[model samples]
Target: MSNTETSPQGSQPDTPGPHSPEPPDAAPKARGLLRSSALVGLMTMLSRVMGLIRDVVVANYFGAGSSADAFFVAFKIPNFLRRLFAEGAFSQAFVPVLSEYRSLKDLAAVKHLVDRVAGSLGLVLIVVTLLGVLGAPVLAAIFAPGFYMNDPLRYGLAVDMLRFTFPYLLLISLTALAGSILNSYERFAVPAFTPVLLNLSLIGAAIWMQPLFQQPVMALAIGVLIAGSAQLLFQLPFLWRIQLLPAPTLGFRDEGVRRILKLMIPALFGVSVSQINLLLDTLLASFLQTGSVSWLYYSDRLAELPLGVFGIAIATVILPSLSRRHAEKSTEHFSRTLDWAMRMVLLIGLPAAMALLVLAEPLIATLFHYGEMADRDVTMAAMSLRAYACGLLAFMLIKVLAPGYFSRQDTKTPVKIGIVAMVVNMVLNLILIWPLAHAGLALATTLSAFLNAGLLLRGLLKEGVFTWQSGWFKWLLQVGVANLAMIGFLLLLAGSAEQWLRFDMWQRVSHMAVLVGGGATVYLLVLLITGMRLRHLRH
Candidate 1:
């Protein structure tokens, strides 16, 4: 609780030389951001690939049936909260404050903050996990009421799975805490790579442990629990290597803990409005049809790949730098960093969204149209996938834009904007669900995200914190031409959804690989032809 400064125990200085005060020029900062983003993107890409494989395995075994629906809901409940609390709000809040301590205070003070926060956060997660396990049935009933009222078998299965999966919140939340610390020090790889462990654990469970359970789907719930433990354990050694392993101590009265809670409380809603919208989709999807939940799940997973890889990677790399810039009061640098992130978002996000929009059916069919998954399921999932794809740009924008506020520790404005967006999403959901069913719900989320991103961007611009740099018009033109070329190439090459379905797994994989690789090549080549050099991206 003391404000006094103290140095760390090692021979090393409190502030490392590599993370010294920012350079005067924007070029070096831009290069560092690009390098860090690439590293995080690579690690995140690996995790996303593993995640797609895990989903494929689940689809092969469970398909879009009552059990798959049940498992998705049960796993979604904790995973949803994990995003809302741990990764979303907690990370957004913790990183900026940690950066401030790292910048202004000594290493010992940083360690104190880490220890107290760990204890406070860990204790809360333990209690929440207990409540979640005990209240699994009630949670199942609340999250998927249609299952409770109309399908008791599915309802019971959800409850049983929830008990096993709910504890994941505790474990994964702790992992996120450790990750936040490592990321603050610019150790982006360890935290970004940690998710691959979860994907691997779930794949192993589905392949090997499914036969061990009578229900079979129960293995996935066990997998969630195992992955959480492994993810948390995997990061501890890295934390020790950094010499900042948390020694947990209750610090409810600590000043640093109080500040984090203050920022975190509002951020729970502000930073995670998109997630809240998705959860709303699940809540409503529960009542739509037998396969509605699974349809949304499959489609959303495909949409998440680009978002997680590029959108999140860019955001993750920038937040610490943004926080440091803010701490240093480098106003121009902060604005330029945000500008660079937006350009990257457009450069990557636009083409990715367009490709998904054009190839939704082929992508879904190729990845998930095997084994227990049926033709109807593939078609329906593609419909929702396209809808989610429509909003991918907004989703990516929000990832970059929200940090504009959080890096400055300004949480209230985003929360207000989030509330308005959430309300609009609920209204859109009601109006669309009756006509479009599950895809309507996906569309509603898409619309709300655009609103969220728009509002966040407007707030930053109005405050004069983010001024557009020169060449935006030319940059946008290049991106637009590149995306048009990519989309045209993809549409021409991607055959009908039925054709994709008829192909064997190897054929689907090979053809899809060609389409992806070929489309990317065209996009990049067009950009190069349009005179977009690497230096343009360096701000």
Candidate 2:
């Protein structure tokens, strides 16, 4: 239903007046957005794969018990903040503004903007981190209130770990600042690959550092801090190569920093509704069974694999391109870019979601059912995984659609939509949790994601900023058929959860590999047969 005929590589408007300078000659070419996205996806895939290994290591050592629950709560607090503040809100606000400055101003002005923003952000995060570490008990109570009532020892452990992990908030936010600057410059790979350090660090900590600590969970907290520093340090050389290495200077009064802060205040809620819902789920889940938090954590990680590799990758690449398009006032190109991204989301997202739903048990069994992980834990995690999988497409769609608003400096609209979705999620949580327990928490999150994505799409349509591409119906039909074919193939191959549990780790891994490879092959073949082709992927 969209006007796909208009190229994403849109023609420039007339020469702009002094107030609105022309886009830089070095701005990323629109046609290359897909290639850039592919690069980011591949890099993210590596990171996500390493992250899975990290989780497997943790699960093997800790399993789904009180210590694991405490550690997850401790980690989730900062990890949630990392996404909400660092990657979600900060990057969303900073990148568009940074892109505009780079396109319109001189390199010196761009460098100054980076320095001032970094200084301001660093100062704020320092205060927040200090408060978090000093007030660890109160912070833990606020995030995992059930800890107070259910198990006092778990609450105590979480408080102790929070002090160790809270510093990661400051470190990773700085890393995100660096990543944002690199992304705006169209140097996407460095930021995309930075996550690998975090995963590798955690893996090492779980494997080697655990024996050194009286409490093994403390090892992961140490890993987080080291990874945060390493990830931040890793991006500096790339920034220096591009001559945007920020010289940190106190610039709270600077115009650009002020603009970013102003945008960030609202954009925080606007960009992070999904995270908020998940955090809420964590809070509520903490009051459930002892291992409820750990179950949700593992399942959420599996769902996030596709979302990271595909959804976030597309969003990351497009935000800069969309910002450039908006800077140039190329409305046609903006719409077409959104159109292209939406198609990519469906083309990949549907199959990925289907695969996750069908193979949830196999994945959980292969990845986490070893050492300390029990069969009951595997079964519980799979339920949550399938629930999260149901909302995968919506989650991925939100990733792409949000940038459409953010790039235009329109933060207010998404804030309103986000608020509505949050309220709806809370109401749904109460309604669903009684019946479904931890799995219900996940289902509520997924259902809320649908609400959020729907509102975002509706807003875009109502404002006439996005139109459905003309071939959407036919495209949907093709994707649906392909998904059904893929699902059927998977269901035929995938055995019961008990069957998966009966296998040794090597057997489970081998079976999963075949099912995954064959499912992808069948899905691709069906899509090709239904008239989808490689050229359709391009602008």
Candidate 3:
């Protein structure tokens, strides 16, 4: 592995090769983290809005039915692997090393690492994609065993769709690799915006191509396949502009590639515990009822909106910054960066979670209760949505906290914590599933997330890697008061689920807009009144 300690101050000599237009600043400025995070957040918000629209369309067409269940499972298998390998482990592993290279080596050396990693990753993905295509039945059966045993038709649909969607793993993982590179250079917008293509492609497929398919859900599968390619292609130009576009070369024996692999292997388990737990929920939910998987999917999508937009946006910006700080041996800056991230997570995550919990039914009913999505589907999905919402803060915490370890290239501690959390989740699933059914699975995941977040925070504290910044008590109290105020406002404004159900789509949209906008306004006002200021969030 490249030595980061060589440059304790993180000063780089001017070396010839392509480099980012931005200057290399070892110490993070007050606006840098917040500005970059906002840019990424804005782009991610666009993608997530499109994703919600796509889900709304899918719900109108498929609803929480057997076909929807099949499609979700098929899509989820690759999506799970994408998060596990690409976004979760690969990003966690690659960014820190990339940061080291950029800080210590010339741009030429950085490009070489990118090329070798690309070639190696691409080769593995091709083999995996081919195997997944050929073994769709096996994958489907393993992921959704209930379908295999009880619903052969659904199982068959899932198997067929898996053949189409599984290749998405290969394409999207490459996209993620490109994204990680872009992120390392602080080019956050393109990668953050790339997901909009997926949502757009899926929306186009559902609207235009569904009629051509004998099984309409299969159109969605084709959409997934197309979106993966589109997303990968979309980032290439930006990569070229940055002059870090990879020219693939086999480099399994290369030192940097080997190091990334070593880190990524352990991180596969450590960084993706939440995804693994969700997949487990899917696995078990497959057996519960026809629509259990779909209910969970809908609810999870809504839960992911704030997470993707804010939690991930913040994490994405911080990893490269944190890694640079670590490379510079700037322990105080690293801890401060983390503290800033945690505060941001709490500032946004608290009210978001409360709003989701308070307005779960209304959100589900407004966005998804249309056409084929029945009232019962909305009710069931809302239940799981609320359950997932309860864990929103924990989920966001994990996003921010895990990066603290990953930026330092320490994956083992999170792996151990993740294992304990996963086991506890399984136990909770078994104990709760009998009584609460699908929502039980959601609840179990939520509870396990709290455990995961708590352990991660504890580890960081114990290591003295993340010291508590002063005024935390005041920060928490202010956030708590603001959140309580938001909750009360939302509960007062958000009518019953049945009222939302009876309203037409326009009414639902208007009412939801008011509740969301109002609740945010109230929360911000309360926080400001409690003496919080924008400057407090600066690192």
Candidate 4:
């Protein structure tokens, strides 16, 4: 996860070590990838549990009110910047450089590389943070325009909260750097699980902060600032264990650091386009009505559960392998490796995406439609959820495909593609917003995602980096068949779930269990009938 891995200074092709090649019967690279993915998935499951708890508390406390709306928009600003810079673009560039350093067995070189990048990044973050702090009101205005026009007090409060919490971008970005270094070393669980601390800190704050402040929203905002600090500190021990814990310095002369900056500039757009696109929707939604932000947030939270579990796990596991393979110039390995990962992504991502579309209402009702959230909010959120699900494959593909470009040290390509797709998204959003309202914005995001995925695939083909095989078509057919089976199973028998789907906590669990269990069985049964062997991706 360290910037050293992807830093421009170390952006060279991977060379084979003396022991690079193994026998053909040797362990398939996909197996190691899947194994690490499973470990990360397991840890992420725990983190998401805490996340759900945190969200439930949030919904209970705020209930899609104006206060909740303001808080989400405020929180999203720094969070988006954190992802845009640290975890998203900066790390993508940094990973390859750091990995190259490891491949070359250059420890001191890696340390110096780490110091330079970390120092330079820290300096950049401070300036960015200050600028953002000064401009929180304007930034909020841009991201959620309705806030300024409709509710002056909420907007002002959001600005003050942003000022308090904006430092989180610096801390979390640095934390992400630490996590990236650990991930490069195959220590996936610790880094993956660190998010749990965030949820816990927020939960603790929510419970205790209320007693301290008469205004619950202000308390929530202060809690957010505390939680951000907690998340940064939580990753410290993990960094120390890996011996890459960065010390404070101002040494920005290192060339490795320069390369990371080079890659990061492009990745800022390439990686953050989806969020940026979503932010655009939030800005538009601000004008629609109250609770628009909450509606989008709730819908996205449902989709994010599966995306985090499967899409993120698969992407995180395969990146190092992809980087290593590309560095080695093993074309066969690279092509086969990518194909295997795509299969894995589709394996989990498709079903997760589909389930949400079919079970949107039930899932939303079971999880949300309680407290002050209301039936109408649930309906609107469900509509948004289905729209979001429609593009899940595309969203997941971006995660998989962008890595192909990043690993090849070609961040510029995705940036170009992202720009085009973003333009389409903006146009579609404008066209659809009037007719479909908030749901249209979501649909626009989904459509633009598939467009981005298509472009990335085309680039991959043009460069001859990867290609489809005979099995690819067969797999697609099987996947379609499985999807049809899932649709009919749920569509025909959804009445059965009505009895099981109650807002009571245990009842909600039982509902998700029955639907997920029944739906999964049908998918597997169809796939088995169509000869979709596990051997394809599991190997």
> Worst ten-residue run, lDDT, model 3?
1-10
Instruction: Highest lDDT: give the candidate number.
Output: 3
User: Which pairs of residues have clashing backbones in candidate 2?
Assistant: 1-468, 1-469, 1-470, 2-468, 2-469, 2-470
Candidate 4: residue 485 Cα off by (Å): 2.0
**Residue range 1-539, candidate 3, lDDT tens digits:** 12211133222322112453334563344247898898889999999999999999999999899999999999999999999999999999999999898877777888899999999999999999999999999999999999999999999999999999999999999999999987776667888889999999999999999999999899999999999999999888767766778999999999999999999988988999999999999999999988999999999999999999999999999999898889889899899999999999998998889888889889999999999999999999999999999999999999999999999999999999999999999999999999999999999999999999999999999999999889999999999999899888888888888899999999999999999889889999999999999888776
Q: Give one digit per residue, the lDDT tens place, for model 2 in 1-539.
A: 11121224322211232323444432344437778889889889999999999999999999999999998999999989999999988899998898788667667788899998888888899999999999999999999999977789999999998999999999999999988987776677788889999999999999899999988878998898999999999988777766778888989899888888888889989899999999999999998987899999999999999999999999998998888889998888899999999999999998999998989989999999999899999999999999999999999999999999999888999999999999999999999999999999999999989999999999999998788778889899999999999999999989998899999978998999999999999999999999999888886
Candidate 4's TM-score reads: 0.92
What 10-residue stretch in candidate 1 is worst by lDDT? 1-10
Model 2, residue 197: C-alpha shift (Å): 0.7
Measured against the true structure, the TM-scores of the candidates, in listed sequence, are 0.96, 0.95, 0.96, 0.92
Candidate 4 lowest-lDDT run of ten: 4-13
| lDDT pick, better of 2 and 4 | 2
Which residues of candidate 4, in runs, are more than 4 Å off?
Answer: 1-31, 496-506
lDDT (0-100) at residue 30 of candidate 1? 42
Note the Cα lDDT for every prediction shown.
Answer: 0.90, 0.88, 0.91, 0.80
Better of 1 and 2 by lDDT: 1
